[model samples]
Target: RDNADNTYTESGTRKRMGRKGIGKLAALSVAERVKVISVRDGDKSGCILSLNISNKNADGKYEIPAIPDDQINFLKIDETKSGSAIIMENSRYSINKTIDSAKRNISLIFPFACQTFKIHLENLTTGATATIDDTTMDIVKLSDALLTFSDEDSEYNEYLNALHGAFDNGRYYRVLQEKLPPDQLPAQKVLHKALTTIKEKMLLVTITGEQKAFDLSICGWIATFASSSDKKRNTDFPVNHISIIANDKLGQFDILPDISTDRMGEAYVVGQFFVDLLEETELPDIAASNRQGYKEDDPRFEKTLELIRKNALRPILELKADATKEKNYIRDLEKANKAKESKEAFDRSIREVVEHPDFKKVIHDSQPVKQALETAWELKDTLKDTYKKIMISHSSDDKPVIDELERVLHFCGFEKEEILYSSSNYYESGFEAYTDIYDYLKNFFVNTTRKTDLCVIYILNQGFVEKWDPVLEAGAGWVLNSTWYPMYTDTFSSVRRPFPGTAYTPKLNFDMDEKQSRTLAGAIYRISQHAGKLEQTEETIFQFIKTTRLYHG
Candidate 1:
């Protein structure tokens, strides 16, 4: 068209959609020849023009021939109309020739254009027409396309029905029963479950801000998937990407490396940032020649990068960590539940075997009876030393401290039966209200033979010295020549010495704060290792020593 000469010009002063003058070369890049037809207002006729883009002379110049007015064909034109048409021939570049593929590519590249412009497409051979608008590119349509399985027959329908049933009723096993004929149902079920997990773990965040430095309005949404598989299935887009869009067109597809080097975090994240300022004519041009990326050193680019890091990347990392923690917690609960079930099953089997009629008969036989008695004797001897390895002596008033110490011993790998304490067994045997304190202590230490072989840990406080039973317990320890480790509280400092010999004791203050409690835990752990009740390792011992110094400082 006569008005279309502006596109072929080298430069212009007015604002324009495209700045480069070489856009017309795109036609040559695609086809070997191009034809142009035009009509203008007030013109009596239309004119046709052609260019041989593929022709070249020996001097490497295109051989474009000039056509005289006599050679040009003219047709009647509408007086009030003006328009131009272009036809490319002998295309050199690949293109999506199908109607659907072409439509999709146009929708993805110029979504906003499809909404504003009256674009109509027609198949010349079939006489079929398609109209594209905003609805044609809606995300809902995309989601439906993704969910549609390749097979359209009843088998795929059954799979979808089972999936829906499983979701509605929370009965996956029932759905698994409705397997497909070709045994593809299990794989589908796995994919469905993985997708469900992804939905459960997915995180979405929206960031909106006005950056005054660039005078730009920025808005974006970042979403994370549960697994790499889920992400791959959901999109062919690059993983862990932050796409930058200007005027609804992608300028940069990925900025992940600029944000962080955390590969584990990158796999789950994908998003886009909309900033129309990059397309403004008032700003210095930063877009690359091919329109694929921005100049790295541009101030606008730097500011946008900073905004994305602060608002998007930080929150994504935190959300990912929280999701991982929640997943681990669920897994641990499932494992514990399974272990409980296994234990119950084992106990039931043992009871069933013992109650069998044949088992009763075997028990009554002389040979079996003799063997059972011998086995019982052997078991008793084997556990005898193990049961008397550690004796814990404390006043009842110090129960809290002793309880905590018992926990520490367990943490250091001591079993429940190996620990001997007065409150656990003494009261059950009616020793709590015994009239003679020394009698109880003498029987507990001498008759049991716990004093000579076992390590005795004394929880020393004012109550231990003031009360007769605790003093008698200490006297018993002296009589049995047991190895004693004193754990003294603040109350013990004000009381008279129960023993004459002066030796340093590990001091603990009552009503301890968190740090002090950790120190006490460390101290108990160390004493247990020294007394041969816990195994020793250099790393464990060093950690304990470091913790013990917290209260001291």
Candidate 2:
């Protein structure tokens, strides 16, 4: 206890994390008595410590009681190794409570869990034991990108390897937008120079009341960035933090609040920095009494914060910005290519149907046939896919409900290609976005063959009844005499025809409830039966609908 002071000289290579004697009193909070046992220089020793805050001696201080050596060795101490253990006796909570809380709490306080030193918690009552190790950190598990800075060569190489691994696996960026040629991207050498520059700076601070200068340098740190901030589910501790570690012990849980600019980019950032100088005994104690963080006014801490803000955090944000731009550029290119390919496929399908043997073998010499063929040319622009048995007609604003409707269709034994929705990929029949709407509808309803085979599900809402596009789709479905069903939310009731005609059938309710479930299931069953595609039983369909939530809006 006498050696516990501001200066540490216990070990040449390792710095002690606990210098104050306050930690020895922590067990007294939860236990009436504690058994201390140790093995040093092949000699075994034991003692019993008992403290009561409510009781005080005549000297106005708590009295420590001593017990026999036999009573102190309650748990067998291993004399084979030089070590120490304190067993809290008559604790307020039992080992069962410790088992539940130890894993997460211990991992947080002692985050440097490694194979060289491992802490195991065992329940003496049930003989259940758990070990805390390096895997508990989960720092590198699901990170999108990581940058490590260290002055040492081995540590720097290790960090470089991790960065390269993330890049190669396509996890370095949420979206890999590298559309430009490889030559255009920054070379690895240039990036290495830029990233490694973080460890080059040193901080100089004057020791208070001594007129002596102290040089401070960062030991190492790891910075992580993720695409999403919802990483608490994957970690045992608070995420998106920049913790400060001094002498292998956590000095501050997070320093980001003090140093951050609070930019949107900061949401993706998380890291830890190590600065042993914060705990240097030769210098004045800069850490707060709680030992959780350094004094804000301390020159040493202020400089360290400035160093991290400029060198460590800023570069990662710049890299994220560059990666995001690249991602968007590549996405645009892919969309453009997809649209072009769809347009070409639409042209090919129309030409194939128009030049079919049935249409080509007509007697052109007849005046009536010639006039009919001429009329057919004007309506031949309509697109058709015989495999598409269902068409979902709804306003673009009602996409959410249409999504649920698609799910129901899929559950009822319909493939993605067997249905058509303007917003979905199944509507690849033509360039619906670029083509003339009136001409396309005219050819689809009035010229297309086998109108009775198609079934349209119109999702009726205020957006649908008021929008010109959805109204046109509804009118086309009616004119073709195609089997159609109208579903509406509370926002609207009856369907208003696009051309002033009325639909006689009642609109099915689309709210998310038991009644809607039964109504939707029955409608789906009947539609499937009409299309000769009935696969799922009515009960099975109802059960599936029970698990899903339909429209609530």
Candidate 3:
């Protein structure tokens, strides 16, 4: 009876769960009274110790009375020679619920207890009973399964081979390893080695750190199901938690907050951190009275947290980030490759159409042909907008007029990026001295892959005819069989004429009032609409030339 009563009466030093000597008070808080019965070898019958915690003295403290052996209640006992039983009576909490909570708490906190002893619970009302054992818990089962295989066994060997295969296959893991510091590789290798040897479907990662001043070695293993699929295989312990183990027993059942910010990683990870240095007698008691967590400022506790963040959590997060980037890169590469293939197929189709004898016959007759031609022009535009669709071929002296024309084109909704013009200095200095101006222009037009549809607007003036570069540029346009529009300045009386067949090319006057600017802009817009399809009406061409004559006269 004395031993049974003393179970909750005495305080003790640190045990496997830490220095939490007040755990017995939990029973007192839930129930009004506690009854302990014992059967010793010397006693003929069992003696019972009863304590009524609800009845307190004037000072709000319970006055427990001392009962002599003769005055103690005696009960018959047939189960064991020396045993004790605790029966909490008139309980404020439900018996079934308390038993359920006790089972879970025992499994988590004292996982090793079932290895050496047996624990059983019975429901008095329903006559149902449950046995709590090591096999009932996931962590205990996983730990046992891991120890089942020897390192030399085929099962272990197969696991190591598969692990290496997986490591080699994972693109992100390779990237992560390459990015980590050289010194950190050894530790990562150790973790990989430890993981491959594990027999169960769990990835066991070991993280270790040394703090010399406190004589602390933060060492632990984070065991998570090898993948999310592995976790879904079991549902008994569905709640995700990372148990904090000091020595071999659990201190805090959930240390997820210190480990991961990502919910997916948190849900799959279940681990135990061993910080035996925290249990040293000289160190201050940092473990909470419930044994669920540690005090915020505990040095050993703080060191363990630091080690976990730096050695384990940080690496995992970085690997995930790298994996995400690699995945995005692959997706983008796939998109670009598809676009390239589509462009190649499109360019081939355009080449077939332009080379066909009936292509020009269908250009104005069929809408589909015109649309295909426009698509071909736009596809070529992707290479270099400068030379593909529209280019202003002019001398440096024609800058003011050409700039105004460019501004008017832009005002008429033409993208400025699509227009190309080179200054006299750019033509001389930008190109190789040996490179002919005509050769440079031909390369520019051909590089765009749209020489057939390229439209060149020539600014004709005294400077334009005198300059060899401008004359060569115009001849290059003719050599490519491109559409050319000659715009001469009103001040220039004499102009170098184009060849007989090219004399019918549309001509515009450079000197422009607001009305002439609008007229020029409208005519350019009308020509551009048909230039892409290589089609222009005689009436539109005549109107453009007539407008130029009206403005010049």
lDDT of 3 by residue, 395-440 (tens): 8776755555654443332444346566422332144457565655
What TM-score fits each model?
0.39, 0.50, 0.41
Return the candidate ranking by TM-score, descending.
2, 3, 1
Highest lDDT scorer? 2
Mind sharing the TM-score for model 1? 0.39
lDDT per residue, candidate 1, 1-553, as tens digits? 0133552334653324554444456566667766555557633332222344466699998765443434333333343586555666787867756666556555444433334464566677776666677522233211111111112332224433332233222123243445324443332221111111000111212123223333444554444555666445322334446677675556677777777534355567655556655655444567776666788877667767776776666555555544443434335446647855875586589668766789767776678675876664454344322235567777887665565555446445455555766665334322345446555455456544532436777777765778876777777886777766667766446334544323334555544555555545555665666556555443453333332322333
Q: Against the true structure, candidate 3 has what lDDT?
A: 0.50
Clashing pairs in 2: none
Query: By the TM-score metric, which is better: model 1 or model 3?
Result: 3
Top TM-score model: 2
Per-structure clash totals for the candidates? 0, 0, 0
Better of 2 and 3 by lDDT: 2
Lowest summed lDDT across 10 adjacent residues in model 1 is found at 191-200
